[model samples]
Target chain A: MSERTGVIHDIGYRPYTGPREGRWGIVAGLLRHGALSTFGFGRSARSKVLPFGLLVVTLVPAIVFVGIISFVGMDSELLNYAGYQQVTAAFVSLFVAAQAPVLFTRDLRSGAISLYLARPLGPAAFALVRWASLVLAILAFVVTPLVVMFVGGLGAGAEVRDELPRFLVALAGALLLAVLLATVGATAASLTMRRGLAIGGTIVVLIFGLGATAILQEIGREQGVEDAAAWLGLISPFVLVDAVQHGLGDAASSFETPPDNPTTAALMLLIALAAAAAALLLLVRRYRTRGSR
Target chain B: MTVIQTRVLTKRYGGSKVAALDSLSIDVGEGVTGVVGANGAGKSTLIKILLGLLSPTSGDATVLGHDIRTEGEAIRTAVGYMPEHDCLPPDMRAIDFVVHMGRVSGLPPAAARERAADVLRHVGLAEERYRLMGGYSTGMKQRAKLAQALVHDPRLVMLDEPTNGLDPAAREDMLALVRRIGHDFGIPVLVTSHLLGELERISDHVVVLDAGHLLRSEATTAFTADTGHVLVEVLGEDAQSRMGQALAARGVAWQPRGQLLEIDPADAPPDALRDIVRDLAAELGLGLVRIQPQTGRLEDVFREEVPA
Candidate 1:
């Protein structure tokens, strides 16, 4: 051996001695990250257009409806809160279809789920966090326009005291719609790693369900089957939201007349709940089994 | 102390008749342990099972004293894993990805960011950390993967095929970094490779698996223990044969090993045999170049120990 020696200089790789939060902190971080990804926060500017554009599209009608009503000095009661959701249902569906893949499919396609699962967060927690973010995103989309409209009615000199309760009920209806759309959208996105396929699948499911249920309800109406027509409305999430709104005595249905009886409202609520739960369960199972791989 | 222990562990895929790991058992101590095998010899499967990514078909294991069955989360929190495949998100910058991974491992945001920067620098990716991972070279991607694994400051790290696609110089750099992780930082490292000889230089202990069965597990020194033979080189013409004949005439057993003469000290001690060879070469008027004892190699052990 040669007579040479070497010294190792310190590079300062200090271990993290700081406080480490537990599972809840991890879940919160993942939720925040997923929510940001839904709107393409950390991504390139080109990626931001679709989700935010649809969001703007969702808000435009509310702004125009409010602007026109305020400027024309029409009855402040002209635009109902629940009726706004019905009118904007297409925009909301498209928003979910476009953005849900950003949250769900990208992770699966890029193998980022492995990194996520390798941490303290379990597969169920991962699924729940993503679902929560999608719900929050859809909620923002649905509730922002309604809030703008509510404020516009106030600015137009509408009575605040009488309108506040209806506004709150409409918020509830909007939340229900957000949860339903999030579940269906996230479930569709979770089934595939292809973004285009996921978007197509979500749009097809929502639109086909709406069109099919409307045609079936028309057939029942021609046959004079009252209860059957009301029951058929449950097939579509849009009609289901309308049925719930009708039960709350807030707004009238735009597609098919809302169910008249309490039993129909209960059935619609039950079916919606079951579908959301089933979709959530599918998500949890899918991640639990395939996420580890 | 044992860092990882498995007892009768077995794993079989859904429709396969052959088990990936068949009732295998091993105890790995706290140091750099090299897991070597040919393709489909269950090296990756073993690492996956240790990380609690894949559940065993039977039996059990523990990493850092946490059960692989019920305490998978706990095990994962303490053990960092660098997978063999390309698992990084293409659109995300390396710094953001590493910071996010640090957060997922439970570090607070500020601490995660600080640690991410430090680990990136330590892995020699400080300048490239700001760029998106999609544009990174294979070497840079491998370093980024290594940085994420170290960012958590885990008790033990399991690296799978970290040198898979590197050139020779990069391979040496990575091996040196692995040695530093185990020796300088005093962290336990469990690294796997399909090539047996690649790990021979840095691993303190080597475990060889053949067809999912344990072929050998021993200290690196034990595998490379000295063989009782000294190789002799000379400068004269017909040097090897001349030295061999002269040594044999003097009752010293010797053989020609290529250009060098190998002297086997049958019953004599090495020092005495070396002196005898020196004297004999001087009297024979042969120019003695060098003489040194031969040490065993891992390739020799493989050829001698592995069953056909």
Candidate 2:
């Protein structure tokens, strides 16, 4: 056999010559990607069905209400800002229940959490950014209709100066509702890797809590324990948000009165905030351990 | 230079009586180092601890000068890891998954995209880069996993069972790629396998683990060095007996080893022994076919060192 020499060819494997934006860059990229995923952007058309369908369902009522008020004139009985969340609470709840799994459970099931944790970002930052993404998406879902109503009421020649303060209060209530619902939904979804289980758990927690509390309050009312019945509203997330709205003097039109006194309203607000805080803690703790293990 | 160092590393899983890893210490340097062990031998546990994904029950380790306990993130940033299990997200396209991983490893957007493409091509997956990972075959998936690990240009890479599910042809291809990663690219590679002899051809050094205990650690050449015994083959009826009789008549120390005569060159230099064998074969009218030294193998080392 003749002697032979090997030839070297350049395959163009270049070293990275650019800046590596450390932890915050990773967090930002994950946050942006997660937010887009929540609304089904950058995914197949089939993924858009539930989130967009719920969104359109939520917006149609606002559009029709605006059209009616535009033609029928601004009566005080028209759908007010504070009553918007109460009217659409079910749609919002279903929206969160369905979409929260898209944000939390999918990663766990797919083992994508390992990829995320392998980066410069820690587990706490990963959880926080994922939670923030859902919060912003749900916040948009909750606030969009309210903004439309405020603009519609003004376009219908309702006095802007008088409606403005109530609009601001409604906006605050919607923000609070969005945060609390998001916290609860994400925490529930984080508990399991199965999307079906996560959705069922979230619905049972929110809807069952509402149903159980409503029954207890009715019994309290029949027994003439007015104070106890008022406090029972704090157990359900929806009733608690409504109570907060009432405390802020922006009670939904369906409520005959605000929660009997300021004490019940204050307790409801504190309890909702505390529950949300606890859920947030649980989410962070879960990711911290699960991501590493 | 040492790329990985562990001192008295021990790990006990929750509620488990036996430690997964028990007082294991190892130092690995640059080049291809193969970690060989059986199933449930703490290979995955050791990799996880080195990556700082799991804390050791006691003791400590360092990867590329960063403490595994305190600077896990820093260590992760510098060392690329391909896990043993199927951890890829099925929904993502290979390009997107690899680019996102590059981003997560701290590369900027444009650089990440560029590097992802480069690494994909390097791993010989350029044709399937655009396809979703769910549609990939086992070989394709392994290549894609390898692509993501190399996208960030890490100084050290830990590949766990890269050829676990490949056919013989694909296993050869994967082993070649691993050899290229260590030799051509000049990057340190720490690859793990359960098959003892599979890594004998590529690894510069080999470390064997049995039941989480360090069985042996040595250079590949050392493990497979010549055993100083020459096997002689002859062409004739009853060739073995003829060769043994002829060699014994010449005062050569010889024994029968299967079909060949084993020659021990006692009190004679290698050259003088070869001359004596040649002269004896000619005088005895025996056709000498071959004479070659026996070499040790990684499997032999494992069999001798690890207790059944």
How much is the lDDT of residue B36 in candidate 2? 91
Candidate 2 C-alpha lDDT tens digits along A1-293: 97779888876556665688888888788778887888887555678899989998999888988888888665734757777877887788888899999888988887777767666676777888889888888889988998888888788877777778888877888888888888888987888989998998888877787778777877877788867677776676677777777775655534333486667788778877887888788888888787557
- lDDT for B283 (candidate 2): 73
* Candidate 2 clashes between residue pairs 3 or more apart in a chain or in different chains: none
Candidate 2: tens digits of C-alpha lDDT, residues B187-207: 899999998778899899998
TM-score of each: 0.90, 0.89
Task: Count clashing pairs, candidate 1.
Answer: 0
Q: Which ten residues in a row have the lowest lDDT in candidate 1 chain B?
A: B299-308
Cα lDDT of model 2 overall?
0.83
Measured against the true two-chain complex, the DockQ scores of the candidates, in the order shown, are 0.56, 0.52
Candidate 1 structure quality by residue, lDDT tens digits, A1-293: 78658878776657666788898888888888878878888876777898888888888888887888889988877768877877877778888999998888988888778777777776788888999999988888888988999998898888898678878878888888888989999999999999999999999988888888888888887888867788777677888887887875546667655688767787788888897998899899999887446
Q: Write the per-residue lDDT of candidate 1 for residues B1-308, one digit (tens) a residue.
A: 88899999999988788999888888888889999888889998898788777889998899989998889889888888888888788888999999989988999999899999988988889899999998998899999999888888998999999899998988888988888888887779999997777788889999888777887889988877888888889878777777788888889888777888877888998788888878877887889889988887777756886766
Please tell me which predicted candidate would have the highest lDDT against the true structure: 1
Best by TM-score: 1
What is the TM-score (0 to 1) of candidate 2? 0.89
Candidate 2, residue B276: how far the Cα is off, in Å: 7.6
